[model samples]
Target: MIHLLYLLALLLCVAPLIPGLLGVVLPAASWLPPLGLNSPSAVAWQQLLSWPGLGESIALSLFTGLGSTLLALLFTFFILRRYWDTPQWRRLENTLSPMLALPHVAFAIGFALLFAPTGWFFRLLAASGLNTDNAINVVQDPYGIGLLIVLAIKETPFLLLMSIGVLQQLQVKRLLAVSTSLGCTHHESWHKVILPLWLPKMRLPLLAVAAYGLSVVDIALFLGPQRPSTFAIQVWHWFNEPDLQLLPRAAAGALLLLAITLSVLLGLRGLEWLLVRGTRAWQLNGPTASTYCGLVSTSHAVNGRYNGAGSPQTLHPALITRLRGCATALRRRIPLFAPFVLIPLLVIPTLLVWSFAQRWRFPDLLPSRYSFRFWEQELEPLLTLTGHSMLLALGSGLIALVLTIGCLEYKQRYHRAIPYWILAIPLVTPQLSLLFGIQVATYWVPGQHFGLWVFWSHLFFVFPYLYLSLEGAWRSYDVRLDQCSRSLGKTAWQTWWQVKRPIVQPAILMGLAVGISVSLAQYLPTQMLGAGRISTITTEAVALASGQDRRVMAIYGLLQGLLPLLFFGLAVFINRRTSRYSSPYSSQGHGPSDTSSTHSGSHHANDTVRG
Candidate 1:
């Protein structure tokens, strides 16, 4: 039964990639029967190369994609280094859910409201009688800097969440203790010891971030440069063109996107290898030696305490020591959490105010006048779109959750697991690349199974996220509980239900929330597969984004962001209730220490589930 279920899971999740890729490959080669282009040719590639601003588009994609991933990575490392085992970690963890729940589209919308040329910031400045004409352009800037910033801020939470599991597996406390015994400060320890281990384990998450940054259509549509947009946006435009003869160019662009994504992933992996594996000197050099050398050579030079001959001179030793102490304290006290928490707080209210503002002009801290006319106008269509969005999200989330459980169970029993690359394919491959191919394959079917195809596509994307979310919980679970239940004359199913399910229920709920959010945020699958028939909140939000009506756009963006938060809230509520009921059983034979550990494990898993 487990074998069959495992096979079914694979069929649903992994098997679809073949047709998806074939769909793109054939079209790119100009083998479209509908277009009467049966023979393969290089005409599409030629056209793609000749397209104006092609180089700029590709450069934008690379710049934003790589740049965002790098920034997010550094920000995550800074947070972890400062607060990983500190009292602030718990508070940081609690804030992650809402941050993670905010869909990228909605975030992009709110970001524009705050940072655009005539946005709230400049308005506030204008109100203070300051010149606002020279305000730096952020939204839709020519350099793609705005897109890079949004992606970096949005992706940092995901990397931090992924780091939780990696840090746990590393037994960070023990590593820190060992390093401290060797006279290494926490700062040096993080760079020399923890970072190496963290990067290798974080390879998959980094690749996922990079891929999303490169192929993201919805967020890029709102915040990305317009004159020559990101590569993915260009491909999106090509696909939407009415001329059927240009289909091959779109397909070729997608193929190129896939190629670029793969190349970047490989490049990242190679860099990881060089940093962690190839360079042993940096990892092996004694922390004290490196620190002493760095401080004496640079710090003393800056302080004018070292002569040109590299000899130390007596120059206010007491003052220098005091200054060093102050610097260390200042570094440790840096407010790393400010931006992460503050941005979302600001964004939510901005969207809310925009949705109701009837007459809001520049340089005003608050709206001049507010009304509910926009909401009243959008109420009916909003309901219809919300219904469709919820249906797809819930259906996909539930199915993906079940399949994820089965796959994890199969791995536990057989001591075999699906290859990481197979799972990462759905994540690290460009969505446009895969969806283009998958959309072509859909035409082979007898009728327009648009809804089915869209749902399946959601499941396809959602499965990977659910799997990654649950993986940590499954790894951390004490299988001994199952053994104890089996020895008590319980069958395998009974043991799983009676013993294992309650312990991991919180993780399961959280994973479901994550899956739903992922499904809710999907724009390409719904747009391409649904053939414009299925208008979910995401599709409608993206569609409304191109218009001049900020009121209507806010309504959609608010709904888009709210749906995911609602699911997350629901999951958290259920998790708490289930935890209460199962507390007795969960604490059995496990004293306060073990109980605390179990709770922490579950909490970590919950934090890990976001997209």
Candidate 2:
């Protein structure tokens, strides 16, 4: 059974990439058959490169994708430097999960609602008589600025949460103590110590961020700059052209996107090397370096802090500088969760009302009259689709859970684990890019196991999150109790069942919840691999959204958001109710040994404590 699951896991999680990659590659090279034209040609590449707006699209994607990622990184690091272990840190940390929970697409829609030209922001501006016509343009701005900002804000929580592990690893508290003892000012120490430590660890997550920025279709469609659109958008439009002869063009565009992802990734790698491993020069040259220069140079560093202390004690040289960084970071923390959490709330209700209202118009706020008439009409069809969706989500999630557990067990047994880079492949690559090949490989099988194909694809994409969620839990689980069990003559499996599972139950539940939610939210894999036959709430919602109908779009959008939100909530509820397993605010598995044992003073990996 164990080996079977491992094989199934490879089928579900690892194998899909084969075809998904080929699907994109073959066409991108301009050799496709479904639409005819078996012979490959560079015509597709020619057409792709010659598109009038292709240049613009590529540029927009680069700026927005790279721009938003860098912004999120800076914002994440700066915020942590301020609140990490302080009293203010607790409040900030509390905001992370909800912020992380809001899905990208739902957040985009809500962002458009709140900030579009005619959105709530303008509505308020008009009401205030504050040059409403000249109100700040936010949604769908040509530069994708609004899209990037919304994405960044939406992403801040994720970056912040990812940092929780890094901060814990960095031994932030002790690092601060050590630096302060050396006469390093708090702000300077933060810029020097925390950032340097966090950036390297952040590489994979940041790569995931960069890839999402580059390939995001749904969010960009809703809010990205469209005058030229981004490369991802162009590839999407090309793929949707419905012309078999033009398949190569679409393929070439996919190839272009793939190339762009690689380039940007390489660029980030280059940037990392420059910032970290590449040079020790700048770091050694910073003011903090003076501390290492001994007592005399410390005097010089002292003067850097006090141009003139006591201006306001807010002008207290060292005090004020530290406060400034912390206070600014602290401010971002409070409202961080509010908009992130509340937007999902708004989307759920609005979409629910929308799905039911037949002729509901805008500007009136609430639906004038409500009816389940649409539900009555669509229920049977929607139910079948929902059945398909549920089966896939549940199946993929459980399979993912088993594989995740196996990998975890493997690590515990051998202290060897899959490299994070390998695990993050699905997260870091474009889903469309990855699935392009897998989709073809599926067709290669010459069978009608579309449901199985789709289920496996969903599992492929979702396992990382499930695995990540459980990794910390498994690590933090106490081994001493298991040893006791062994001493009492219980076998390993028995030990895991009776002792290990209970303590880490919350993490398991949380991992399951996350896995299920990710499965529920899959769009690209389902649509592409299912060949338009399988319709989940996401594919349906996305399709309906394309119609641009306020009422109908909102309706589908709500269902799309609700399905995962429901699962995510249940997971959280179970996790919380199963308290004593782990604290809600607690990082995964923080055994005291984490701090005292390996890498003491290393707040860079806060999760070690969670263990």
Name the candidate that leads on TM-score: 1
lDDT of 1 at 198: 90
Misplaced by over 4 Å in model 2 are 33-39, 285-385, 414-416, 478-480, 581-611
lDDT of 1 by residue, 1-611 (tens): 77876888899999999999999999999999877898999999999999999999999999999999989989999999988977677667667668888889998898888888767877888888999788789988899999999999988877776676578779899998998888887888888889898998888778889999989999888788999899999999999999989999999999999999899888988988887888778767767576778766776665656679977786687887888899878865666876777787688888899999999877678888999999998999999999999999999989888888988999998988878779889888999999999999887888878889999999999988888777866876778988888999999999888778887776787778888998999999999998898899999988888756988898898989988888888876665556657644432312211111111112245332221
- Mark the 10 consecutive residues where model 1 has the least summed lDDT: 592-601
- The lDDT, on a scale of 0 to 1, for candidate 2 is 0.69
CA lDDT of every candidate = 0.83, 0.69
Q: How close is candidate 1 to the true structure, as a TM-score?
A: 0.91
Tens-digit lDDT track for model 2 on 239-265? 777766776787777777888998999
Q: What is the TM-score of each candidate against the true structure?
A: 0.91, 0.83
Candidate 2: Cα lDDT at 573: 63
Model 2: worst 10 consecutive residues (lDDT sum): 594-603
